[model samples]
Target: MGIVVALWAAILGALAVAKYRKEAEAERTRIRDMRVVYELQLSREIAARRRHEMTVESRIRRELESESQADTAEQVAALRHELASMRGHIEYAISNTADPRRELTAKPHGDVRELVVSDNAVTDADPGRTEQQHDQDVVDAEFETEYQPSAHAKTR
Candidate 1:
């Protein structure tokens, strides 16, 4: 009977130890899985941060690059092209609007006075004197006669 009881106690102890080992192994597996998940999450976060940093760095680099006139000659050429285009437009408009080479004479002054035409020698003045001078003299004489003050107004 004592031997049977001891054998039964030993069997129970072995079963308990086996159960404890299984539970410990399960806990270790759970912890390992949790560590794996944490490591994966950390790796993903680091990659995202690196990507963002690279993007921002590229944007900053682009902004700095824009400040420089790297293609100075090209830009100048483009501006010259634009100026030439504008000149072409202006030339086209001038050519289409009127005769570009035609000389434009200034309009003649108003003919307010009537001159009598006579083939006979009218005035023996210098031939160098122009008709405009004679007309101005005639206009002065006409203004004196036309704007003469009334006798009553003149006395006042």
Candidate 2:
């Protein structure tokens, strides 16, 4: 009877040790899984924050670029308007002004014709009184004078 009771006591002690070891190993596994989940959550949060920052930076850059383009366009338009106004002012100045010398020199004189001789005449009065000489005499007149040569004659 003593031998049987001792064997039963030994078997009960072995079963209790196995149950305690199994429970401890299960607790350790649960702690490891929780740590893994916590790390995954932290990584997700970091990635989300980086994405948001990038989006904000991109939007800011686009806005600044658009504003700069608008400013450039406006300046170009203003310069074009100024150039058009200058052209108009120049045209008006050319149209409205008149030269008094041109008007005074345009009148014809009848007395100068009496001194001119035809090309066929051979007058011995003065060698310089011929038609060619007379034409040369009027060459020194004002450029705007009525006796000025035509455009075709000036080319020759």
Candidate 3:
């Protein structure tokens, strides 16, 4: 009878060990599945964040390019205006002479007033202002009065 009781006790101990091993395996599997789910969520979140950052960077780049283009356009417009002012000055100088090409190329020998239209010689005989100063003043006045903004310039 004692031997029989000992054999029964060993059998019950073996069954208990097997049941514990099965439960442990099931717990391990549950933990592995949970870890996989968390990793997937983390990866999705990281991808979303990266996409947002890229979108923001793209927007900033576009804005910078637009500003650069606007600056370039403004500079072009200013250059055009300066060129127009210079053209008006040249036209004023040319119109005052009897022979535009000859007077422009020739040197003044006898009378400086005859070769070039001097403000001091023609209308304002201001003794204070020299011939060069009068010429500069005329140019300044003509630039102020005759400088018409081009269509592109007016829009700016």
Indicate which candidate wins on TM-score.
3
lDDT of 1 by residue, 28-131 (tens): 99999999999999999999999999999999998877765567767888987776665455444434433222322223573322222223434335687676
TM for every model, in the order presented, reads 0.42, 0.45, 0.59
Tell me the alpha-carbon RMSD of every candidate.
Answer: 19.9, 18.0, 12.8
What are the lDDT scores of the predictions, listed in order? 0.63, 0.63, 0.69
Give the per-residue lDDT of model 3 (tens digit) for 1-156.
Answer: 999999999999999999999999999999999999999999999999999999999999999999999999999999888767656655666676543123332235653222344333343446677667756554544333334655445566
As a TM-score, model 2 comes out at 0.45
The residue pairs that clash in candidate 1, if any, are none
Q: Name the weakest run of 10 consecutive residues (lDDT summed) in model 2.
A: 98-107
Candidate 1 TM-score, C-alpha based: 0.42
Off by over 4 Å in 3: 99-156
lDDT for residue 70 in candidate 1, whole number 0-100: 64
Q: Clashing residue pairs in candidate 2, if any?
A: none
